[model samples]
Target: MLVSLFDQERSFTRGVDPMVLVSPSIDEEMRRKRVEEENRENNSVPLVEEEKCRLQTEILGVKCSLLRMERDIAVMRIERRVEMERTLKFIVQTYLLSLFD
Candidate 1:
């Protein structure tokens, strides 16, 4: 009986009061909007949590890459030092051979 009061007419009528005509539709639209907004609010909590987890994983990946780069640099430096020592020993040995000749 209460809903009947707000029930809309299906057929178009001329010169009916616009307020009475549009009121039920407006109320229903407002109720739908409110429900959608509540759903969005409820969903934001998990969205925020997912973002936090993604950031932590990215940080861990960056740290691991940095460690790998540091290890590679150290290995290159050792190889360079060994090569320099071998070149120095070859130079000294050649000089001694020339002196004997």
Candidate 2:
């Protein structure tokens, strides 16, 4: 009978083997391995969350810095335009004076 074969601590390859037919020692080992793997996966979840938060914070910081740079560049362009206009006016005045002389 199936019970007798299992009771004798023998492995049968004839059909699908239930968990009971497998040795309790092997079953326990498998259960321990599964528990350890689950624990490892669970422990890594927090680390993944922490990394995500850090990356988001870093991205925000970079965006703020870029905005500041853009504003500074706009100010510099306005200043250069003013300087060029003044120089052009001076050149025109000098040319008119020379023509009259």
Candidate 3:
């Protein structure tokens, strides 16, 4: 009688315990949930990729503009240097010509 009672108790406990039963349907549902999550993540990936590409494009445009500005500044610097050299040469020539006159 004690053994029968113990067996019944074990059966009841196993029936009530969630870990005791692993149904294939439960596994399929879990797999379905995981697939759904992965699908959601995959769907968002394209938006993230697009945002990354847009940011990269904007960064490249800013870099190009900066490069253009740097080139313009360099050209202006060279032009100023040449102007100064020409002015100095004219002054020296005028002074020498006056001394001769």
Candidate 4:
């Protein structure tokens, strides 16, 4: 049912005309816009690239910090489990000794 509805919508939408879509006037306008965009990009590419590099480096640093935090948490969990086991063993041993006495 959803597929049929989507098909209906697709049919209702205007299909592209090959000739008009690729007309000379349209092509010229597109070319002009593209050239303008390229000029702007040429001006800003270095700055944009520099910012992107900095952001990527910061992201890597954050990821490294997160990994270290995760490792620290894992180590703490292991230490906590060991401590609990030791405490439980001591309690059981004391209880057994009392029973014997």
TM-score of each: 0.52, 0.56, 0.66, 0.54
For candidate 1, give the lDDT of residue 16. Answer: 75
Which lDDT tens digits does candidate 4 get at residues 30-81? 9999999999989899999999999999999999999999999999999999
lDDT, candidate 4, at 18: 26
What is the TM-score of candidate 1? Answer: 0.52
Better of 3 and 4 by lDDT: 3
Candidate 2 residue-wise lDDT, 1-101, digit = tens: 56776665466455765455445677899999999999999999999999999999999999999999999999999999999999999999999999999
The per-model lDDT (C-alpha) reads 0.85, 0.88, 0.88, 0.87
lDDT of 2 at 95: 98
What candidate 3 gets wrong by more than 4 Å, as runs, is 1-29
Q: In terms of TM-score, which candidate is strongest?
A: 3
Clashing pairs in 4: none
All candidates in order of TM-score, best leading? 3, 2, 4, 1
Residue 72 C-alpha lDDT in model 1: 100
* Local lDDT at 30 for model 4: 95
The residue-level lDDT of candidate 1 at 14 comes to 63
